[model samples]
Target: MEIDPSEVQSLYRTLAGAVVPRPIAWVSTRSEDGVDNLAPYSFFNVVSVAPPVVMFAPVDGQDGLKDTPANIRETDEFVVNVVTEPLAEAMNQTSATLPHGESEFDHAGLDRAESTTVDAPRVAKTPVAFECSLYEMIDIGASTMVLGEVEWVHVDDSVTTDDKLDVEKIDAVGRLSGSLYATTDDRFSLERPP
Candidate 1:
């Protein structure tokens, strides 16, 4: 059945549900006043490889820009932490909206690790974290698509094999419809048609 987004009563839910599984970018940023913020965005993906750019769309909230996007706008720096099965619950906790000056890292009871190149702190327990600088911010309707250039990457030795990240060693978590989440265990590979 074809459904028009404008006609659907629950277009957000419909599109979110139809998207199957989406990777979560647990983005962390620092406010201009140095207040750290963390939030998870499922509307995220890698945009380029050469310069190593990633994009995450954060929809504007009722009062205006969310803390993450606002902080990025001010500082022009952020960190994208990878969400895994072990940290799924904590990641969800960080999604809560708190006072403007409050920090999700403290709210979620997570430790902060100093980033190599950015002022924003990274999740200490995260298996992988990409320290990025703002590449651009584009307004797409109600959402702001934040593009960041990866300046430094932190990968836990346990999750890597011979200096490369091994997916088999990583138990990444993904977003499903509503409050549901998925694991990468059921993955399958296909060869390129040459």
Candidate 2:
């Protein structure tokens, strides 16, 4: 199907607009006014490894920058929580449009644990969490692309295998176009030849 994005009513609802296998970023940020905001961004990925940088884009809000972007700008810190199958529903709950000064952690009934390297708190249920400091933020069209330098990483002992993290054990979830979600249950692997 050859469909132009400009012709579509909403880009996000169209199948061809959002690429599949999009990673889920359960971002946690604290507003300058001391409000904790948590939200999931499917437009997220690891951009670099040498300095351990990750990028997530938060679409522009009608009022301006969203809570997460504004919070990161003010505090210069955030946490990226890995959303596993068990925590999928809780993560979705955080995506709701709640009033200011309200915390999604409490609303979602998720435990908030302190981060070692950043002020932002991590989700206790996530298999992995990356504590990051703001590296850069760029305004791209209708979205704000945020780059974060990972300062500390926390991995659950259960998900670690043979000194490496196991994808199957983590059971991570991914976001698809619309309201669809996917799991890592269907697996395949390939190794490059020497």
Per-model TM values vs. the true structure: 0.97, 0.93
Q: Report how far residue 110 has shifted in candidate 2, in Å.
A: 1.1
The lDDT, on a scale of 0 to 1, for candidate 2 is 0.90
Predicted candidate 1 versus true structure: per-residue lDDT over 107-174, tens digit per residue: 99999999999999999999999999999999998899999999999999999999999999999999
* Model 1 worst lDDT run, 10 consecutive residues: 5-14
Q: CA lDDT, every prediction?
A: 0.95, 0.90
In terms of lDDT, the poorest run of 10 residues in model 2 is 9-18
User: Model 2: how large is the Cα RMSD against the reference?
Assistant: 1.6
TM-score of 2: 0.93
Off by over 4 Å in 2: 5-10, 15-18
